[model samples]
Target: MVDTMKAAVFQGEGRLEFEERPIPQIERADHVIVEVGAVGICGTDLHALKVPPGTLSRIPTGVIMGHEIAGRVAEVGEDVLSVKPGDHVLVDQNAPCGMCEMCRRGRPNYCISIRNVPGFPGAPNTYGLFQDGGLAKYVRVRELNVIRIDRSVPIWQAAVAEPIGVGLHGLRKVNVRVGETAVVLGAGPIGLVVTALLKRSGVGQLIVVEPLELRRQAALACGATAVINPKEADTVERVLAETNGTGADIVAEAVGWTLDTCIQVASNGARIILYGESELDDVIPIAPTLIGIKELEIYGVFLAPFVFESARSILESGTLPLDQIVSHRLPLEKVHEGLDALRDGRALKVVIHPNEF
Candidate 1:
C-alpha cells in the first residue's frame, strides 16, 4: 500500500521546500524502509545550499536531502535478516556499486560505478547527495546500509554516528600516536568528534582552533586541551609557543581550506588530515615548497570507510557527549530555518524529526 508523507525537498540554491511525498516501501528482497527519527543537517547539506545552482554535480533538484540518519525499521523485505521491523538502526550514507574495481578492492567508498549506474536515484553518488535521502518520514535503503544499534541509545545520538564515523576514518588515516601533540582546526560537529577521538586515544595535547565562542566551549567539553580563538589571538604563534616552538605532531583540518594554517603550526614530519567538505569551485593556494621542506605527509578522507561500527561503539561508551553537539531540534516543516541556523553559524548540529509536526 502506498502512503504519502511529508519531506523536505531541495530545490535550486537556498531553497528547501517541505512537501508531501510517497512513503517508501520495501522494493527489493534486501531492502528496508526506515521511519526516520533523527536526521542531522550535515556540512555537505549546508554547503550545497550555499553554492550556486548546477555547481553540485549530478545532484538533481527536488531530491529529499538529509543523509545523517538514525531511526527504527518500519518494514523489511523478505530476505533481509540483518535487521527486523522495529529495530533501531544507523543508516550509512555511502552507496557503492559492488561490481566495480574499487568495490572489488574493498574500497567501495570509491566505487568506480557510483555515478555511472543507471536507474538509481543516486546511482553514481551516495544517498542524499544525488538521490532521495532520510529527511522525511520514511526512506528506503539496502540492508547493507543499515547497522543495528542498541535500543537504549537515543536516536539523535545514533544519528551523530555518521559524522563521528568520518572523524574516525580521518583520525585513522593520520594514525595519531598516543602522547603526541595534535591540533584540530574548526570546532564544528566533525571537529569536535575528531578532538574527542584524539583525546580518548590519549593524545598528550589537543588544541582546537575556532573563531566562535560557543564551538570553542563545545571543543573543550569534548576534551580539547586548549581552545584558541583565531579571531582574537595568533593561532600559529599560540600553537608554536604551546609546543615550545616545535609545533603539533598531527594536524587535522575539519574546516575547509585550512591547510595553510595547518602548515604554519605543523611540526616537521607531521601528518595532516583534510576531511572538511568544501564547495566544488573552492580552491586554496598553498606553498608546495614548504610542504616538501617540512616533509609533511598530507591525507584526504572522504566518506566513512568501515568506521560506523567503531563510531557507534565509541558513542555507546559514553565518552563523547553526542547530545551537546546538537544546538537545534527542528521538525521537518522548519527544515529551512534549521539550514539557515547552520549557514549563520548559530547552530552546530541541527537534527530534524520527520515524524514530528
Candidate 2:
C-alpha cells in the first residue's frame, strides 16, 4: 500500500517547505514504518540549510532534513520482532558494520564502512547527508535504528536520547570515573546532556562553559556545579578556579574551534574528549609542548554504537528531565521557522510534530 504524508523538505538557502511524499513502507523483512510524533531540530539541519559544510556544501536543494526523532511504530515487517505496532520508539542516528574492528572494539559509531551507510538515502545515493534525513511524517528505519521505549514514557523526553547517546560515547571515550572532575565546553543541547549524564554518573564536580546567558542557566538546571561565561572572565581561569587550580580531571570539548580552551584549562593527566565538529577554517593554537609534558590523553568520539539498549533505559527512567529543554513546538508545516530559530540560537531544542501538537 502507498502512503503519502506531509513532510518537511529542504528547499535551499536556509529554507524548508512542507511537502507531500510517499510514506516509506517495508520492502525488506526487517524494515519498519514509524509515525513520527516528535522530531528535534539539530544543529546539523540548521547548518545544512544555512552554511552547508562538508558533503552538505552542495546540497541538492530538495530532500527531507533532520536527524533527531522520537515516535511510535506504525508497522513492522515480518522479520521484525524487536518492536511492535503502538510501541514508543527512538531512532539511533548511526549505523555500523558489525564486523569492523571499530565495531568489534565496541565502537560501532566509527564503522569503517560508514562511507556508504545503508537504508538512509543521501548524496550519490551512496553518500547520505542532505538527500534524505529523518524529519518526516514517517520514516523507514532499517530496524537497526529502532529502539523501543516504554509506553508510559513521554515520547518528547525520550527524543533527548540521541544527544545523550552522544554524551555516552564521549564519556566512555574519556574513561570518566565516579570522582573525576569534568569540564564541558559549550552549553548547547549536547553539552547540557553531557553535563547531566556526568552528574548522573557521579562526577565529583562539573563546570560548563557557555557564552549565552540562557544556556548558562540551562547548564545550572542540568546539574552543572559552575557555569563559565567566557566573556565575563577568562574561561580557563574560571574552570581552573573551580578545580582549585588543579584543572578538571576530564574535559569534554563539545564546542568545536575552541581547542585552546581545552588546552589552557585541563590539568596534568586530564583526558580530553573532542566531540564537536566546528568549521574547518577555525583553528586553535595548541601548545604541543605543554600537551606532551602534561601526559594528557586525547580521544575522539563520533556517535553511539550498540548503545541504544542502555540509552533507552536512561531515557525511560526520566533521569535528565529533558522535556524542559524544548523551547518551541511547531507543526511540520512550520519547520522553516523552527530551523530559523535554531540557526539564530533562539530555541534550545525546537521540535516539529507530524500533525498533532
Candidate 3:
C-alpha cells in the first residue's frame, strides 16, 4: 500500500484543494481503513462551503469534506468481526457513542456527547467534517460505522446509500398510503429519491413544486404526476387545485429555506414531513393557530438510523432509476466542477472518484 494518497482538502469557505495526504491506518481496535471508491456530492457539503465565513465553526478548514461515501475495506482492526478486508461497504455518516442518551433511545443522530468527540465540535459527530472522509483515496472509519453491502451493486449507487437511507427513513415514518396524494417541495437528489419511493409505494397522485426547470422535469421522470414551477404559478393554489381543493394527504418539505410552502399546501389532518435541513440558526415563520385548526402532524428526519438496510433493499429492488440522478463524474482534482454544477442547478448528483486523479 502507498504511504501517501491524494485528497481534496477543504481550504476554508468556498475553497477546496487537491493535495497529497497520508493514508490512514486502523489506530483503534474497532477502527477500519477503507479505500474510498466513490463519494457523492451532497447539498450539505455545498452549504458548508457556501455559508458565510465563521458560520460553520464546527467544520474547520482542511477537514476532508464529503459524507456520502462507499468503499472497499482495505484493513480492519483485530476486534473488527462483522467485516473483512476486500468487503464492499457504505460508511454510516454519523458515529454515536452507544452509551449516550440519544443512542440508548435509538436516536443516535442527536448524540449528546458530540461536542466532546475528538474531531469536529458543535454538530453531531460525522465524517467529512470531524474526521477525514471519503473525498480521498482512503478514509479511516470505525468498524461499527461501516455497513457491508452487496457487491453486485455499482459503487456509485452504493455511495448514495446515505441520502437514499434518509429519504426512506422519512417515508417510513410518514403516513402515505396507496391511492393518496403526496406533495414534494424541492426536486433535488433527496426530493427525487422521495418521489421515486412514493411512486413505488403506489401514491395515486404525486405533485412536485420546484423553481428549477431541469429539476421539475427530473421530478416528473421520477414519478411525479404533476410538476409546478413555483416561480410562475402559486404553489399552494396549484397544489390545492390538483387535490380538488382539499389539499395533499402528505407533504414532504424537502426545501428547508422556508416552511410556508408546505404549510400552505397541507390538508386537514395531513402529515407534513420536514425532511430537509436548514442552517443551524435559521428560523421560519409558523402559525400556532393554523396548526391547531388544521391538526397537521409534522415529522422531523435527521440521520439514516436503521434505514440503511431498507435503503439497500430499495436500491436493489430497482424501482428507482438511481443512475438517472447521477449526472456527472469527476476526478478528485476537479471536484470543484461537481460542486459548481450542483450549486448552479446544472446537476442532480455528482460522484467523485478519488482514485482517478
Q: Pick the candidate with the highest lDDT.
A: 1
TM accuracy, model 2: 0.90
Off by over 4 Å in 1: 51-58, 113-122
Q: Please give the CA lDDT of all the candidate structures.
A: 0.84, 0.76, 0.83
For residues 261-293, could you state the per-residue lDDT of candidate 2 as single tens digits? 787788999999898876655566788887888
In terms of lDDT, model 3 sits at: 0.83
Which residue pairs show collisions in model 1? 114-124, 115-124
Compared with the true structure, what per-residue lDDT tens digits does model 1 show for residues 220-313?
8888989999989999999998999999989999988888999989999999999775555678888788898999999998778798889878
lDDT of predicted model 2: 0.76
TM-score of each: 0.93, 0.90, 0.93
lDDT (tens digit, per residue) of candidate 3 on 1-357: 669888888887668788799989779999999888899998778767764733433477878888898889999999999999999888987888888667799877768644433343535557887678889889999988898887888888888898888888888887579998999999899999899889988999999998998888889889999999989999989998999999988899898865777877888988888887776677887776777799988899877788888877766666788876788888877788898888788999899987531
